[model samples]
Every structure is written in structure tokens, then in C-alpha cells.
Target: MEILKRPMGDYQTNCYIVKIDDKEIIIDPGMGATEWVMANVKNPIAILNTHGHFDHVWSNSELQSQLNIPLYSPKGDIVLMQSSTWMPELPPSTPDIAVDGDKTLDISGIEVKFHHFPGHCPGCSMIEIGDAIFSGDFLFEGSIGRWDFPYSNAESMRESLQKFAKWTIDKPLYPGHGNPTSVRAEQRNVDYWLRIV
Candidate 1:
């Protein structure tokens, strides 16, 4: 598995392209980088959004239309996904699959597991592919996600953090922002946020 990171949009959100077996799976197609992603990868299987934030799903509709691929997201975030004020102009291709709890999908022979973890947003999820997990806004390098947004909940964020701490796999965490980190490192250093609440 290969992971490609591109900084996109006004927030410089990290758009990730995971390639395996000549098929590409785009995560958080932030903005305006659709051509860049398509040019680099062969056949795109689908677009997967960890959450429906403006910064994460900006290019989703465009990319999905261009590639004629499905879009996958959690079921609980449809409200956020439909907000025009938060998102740019989108196409009619909403998420074809709405995942709940833990579900796995095999895309072109590569397996990707979805883990529902809401805090930053009501339906935020993490994608586990190979040895890396795309944590979105839930867990960052040394800090946790902010819970000040309308859909964000402080208690939920704390619970999600604890859930993450219990995971046995110590894979590298590819968050929606900042540098990448390992699960073990986060577990050891994340006490700062966990202890406060």
C-alpha cells in the first residue's frame, strides 16, 4: 500500500490517495486537487470521506463525477454533508454507502476498514488501510480534535480518545491535519488531553 498526501484548499487540508493493486482510493479530496490525484493514479475505485466537513469533502463531488466512482461516508453525517454554507457547490452524488460501527470494504483487492468515531463531527470515522489509519480530525499527532463546532461534543471526543487508546494495533496515524504519528506515541503522549476532561 502506498499513501500520497497533498495539501489543499484554504485550510491546507491533507488529501490522501491510497494506492494498492493499481487502484486508487481517495480520502478527503479537499479542493481543486482532483486533476493532480487523477494524473498520478491509475484507476480510481472510489472516494472516501472521513467526515463531511467543508475542508474534507470540497472536491468529493467533482472527483466522483469525473471518475464515475462511488462515495462512502458514515450514516450520521448526512446533515453536515448537505450543508451548502459549509460546503462548496456539490454534485448530486451523495454517499452511496453509509457505514455504521465497523465495516470493511474490499476495493480492488485491498481491504479498508471503517471505524465510526464521532466527536469532531457527529459521524466522523477513521479508515484503516494496511498499517496506517486515516484518523481524520479525531486524533492528531500530539493533540486531539477540537469540540467547539456545532456537531462537536467534548464528552464524545474524550470517549473516542479512550477508544483509540484501547486499540491494539500501533499503526501510523494519518490525521486530516499536521504531521503523521504512531498509535503508540499518541497513547503515551495523549494524556494531556485525556487528563483535562
Candidate 2:
């Protein structure tokens, strides 16, 4: 499996293209991502969203139309997927598949896992494919996602963090922003956050 990454739009949201054999899955196709994705992928299969935040799914509709593929988004964030209270100018897109919490499925022959962690938003999740986890805005290098947003819940975030801290298996973490970290590395940070709380 080969993963290609490009940060998009003003937010510099990291858009990823996970290539497994000839099938490619687009994850978090943010603002200004359509052109880059179109250029890179030859046999695109699916578009997966970590959450419904506008910055993370700006180019969702365009890519869906162009690539003619199904979109899998978190069921909890379905409201955010259709429209955003924060960004009314956001292009509205519909999800072909509304993924429930902690679900796994096969995209063609490849395994796609969605680990639900609702805190940053109603349906915030981390997508796992192979040995890497695409932790969209949840677990970053030295920080965690903010629960100060419109639909964000601090208590829920705390719960999610606790669950995350209990994880024993280590994997490469590709976050929404900044450089990549690992499960073990961020477990230490989770410990820090838990300590202060």
C-alpha cells in the first residue's frame, strides 16, 4: 500500500490518497483538492470522510461527480455533511454511505475501518487502513482536537481520549494537520491530558 498526501486550502488540511494495488481511496478531500486528486488517481474507488467538517470535505461533491464513486461519511455527522452552520458558503454534498460508530467494511478487496471518536464534532472518526490510522483532527502530534466548536463536546472528547489511551496496539497516525505521529507517542500525550483533567 502506498499513501500520497497533499495539504489543501487555507487551512492546510491534509488530503490523503490511499493506494492499494489498483484501487485508490480518497480521504478528506478538502478545499482545492479536486484537481490534485483527479491528477493523481487512476482507478479511484471510494471517498471516505473522517468527519463532516467543511475544511475536511470541501471538495466532496466535485470529486464524487468526477470520479463517480460512492462517499462514506459518519452517520453521526450527517447534518454537517449536507450543510455547515459555520460555513454556509460550503458546497453541499450527500454521502452515499452513512457509516455508524466503529464500523469496518471491505472496499472492493481492501479493508476500511472507521474508529468513531466523537468530540471535535458529532461524527468525528479516525479511519484505519492497513497499519496507519488517519486521525482526522482527533489526535495530532502534540495536541488533540478542540471541543470548542459549534457541535463539539468537551465531555465527549474526554471520554474518547480515555478510550484512545486504552489502546495497546501501536500504528502510524496520520492526522488532519501537522506532521505524522504514532499511537504510542500520542498515548503519552493522552496521559498528560488525562492527568490535568
Q: Compose the digit string of candidate 2's lDDT tens values, residues 115-150.
A: 999999989999999998999999899999988898
Model 1 RMSD in angstroms: 1.7
In candidate 1, which residue pairs clash? Answer: none
**C-alpha positional error of residue 15 in candidate 1 after TM-score superposition, expressed in Å:** 0.5
User: Candidate 2 has which clashing residue pairs, if any?
Assistant: none
Assess every candidate by TM-score. 0.93, 0.97
Residue-level lDDT for 111 in candidate 2: 93
Best by TM-score: 2
Q: Write one digit per residue (lDDT tens) for candidate 1, span 1-197.
A: 88999988788889999988788899998777787788877888988989888788877778877889889988877777776565546533378888776789886678889998888888889999998899898878887778888888888878887887788888999999989998898888656777765
User: Model-by-model lDDT, in order?
Assistant: 0.83, 0.93
Query: Which candidate tops lDDT?
Result: 2
Assess the local accuracy of residue 85 in candidate 1 as a C-alpha lDDT between 0 and 100.
61
